[model samples]
Target: MKDCENLATCGFFRKHLEAKTLACQGFIRQYCQGDKQDDCKRKIYKQQHGVPASDDMLPSGQLLAGHEK
Candidate 1:
């Protein structure tokens, strides 16, 4: 489906638009215009995954490393 169409159907998007929140409208105006689907994808990915789409926010730690006294 197209990005605009997908966004229009999103529950969060629809709710925010219906509520007429300034931030939501601004975001839609900025990222949901024309062919910039990646913006929507990243937003949705963050919503579903509970983290930023990029790796920068991931927790830093050594795998299987025990506590060091």
Candidate 2:
């Protein structure tokens, strides 16, 4: 999908979900431990599951809508 491709360009959808999740939990990124690829995989997972995020952000309770993860 064009929309998904666009979101992937800057990793906005990818980072936004991670950022939102962290923000929701009040994480301050106090450490430098990194796992960039995993985050991307999450985004892809969200996508394949038909989440509502720009790329694929599962809704609060939908858990990826009608799709299985």
Candidate 3:
């Protein structure tokens, strides 16, 4: 499956499937906008660690294997 497809099945995504709150909605929106991808290091870290990402986390070039980019 594609990276985004895999992300779609993650527990976090599932939990916020129908949420209208900013955090949940923003996650979906950013993901759809291609902001969360292999090129986005913060997203890669969040996906690997299952942690919530923050604006303070800066982007890097490293990619997390097996994670949705």
Candidate 4:
């Protein structure tokens, strides 16, 4: 499948795509540009809430390390 339609504008990708952490980058690879894009919590939350989740929200629906925003 193609990459996510929201890749360019996704809050998570725009904010964290450049993160040096392997886990962070892995999330991007696993969701933003992979087959799992359809399951991204960020996309799901946006669809459900009509707004983006917090910047610290991972595509897996978890918060970033030490981050609860």
Pairs that collide, model 1: none
TM-score of each: 0.43, 0.20, 0.40, 0.85
Worst 10 residues of 4 by lDDT: 60-69
Per-residue lDDT value at 58 in model 1: 12
- The weakest ten consecutive residues by lDDT in model 1 span 55-64
Which candidate leads the pack in TM-score?
4
Query: Better model by TM-score, 1 or 4?
Result: 4
TM-score of 1: 0.43
TM-score of 2: 0.20
| Candidate 2: count of backbone clashes, pairs at least 3 residues apart or interchain | 1
Query: Best to worst by TM-score, what's the order?
Result: 4, 1, 3, 2
Residue by residue across 1-69, what tens digits does model 1's lDDT show?
344545544544554456555654565565554454455654566668775443211111112122121
User: RMSD (Cα, Å) of candidate 3?
Assistant: 9.7
Error of 2 at 30 (Å): 15
Provide the RMSD of all predictions against the true structure, rounded to 1 decimal: 12.5, 10.1, 9.7, 2.5
Which candidate ranks first by lDDT, i.e. highest? 4
| Of 2 and 3, the candidate ranking higher by lDDT | 3
Global lDDT of model 4? 0.84
lDDT of 4 by residue, 1-69 (tens): 788988887878877766547777898888998989999999999999988888788999998777323
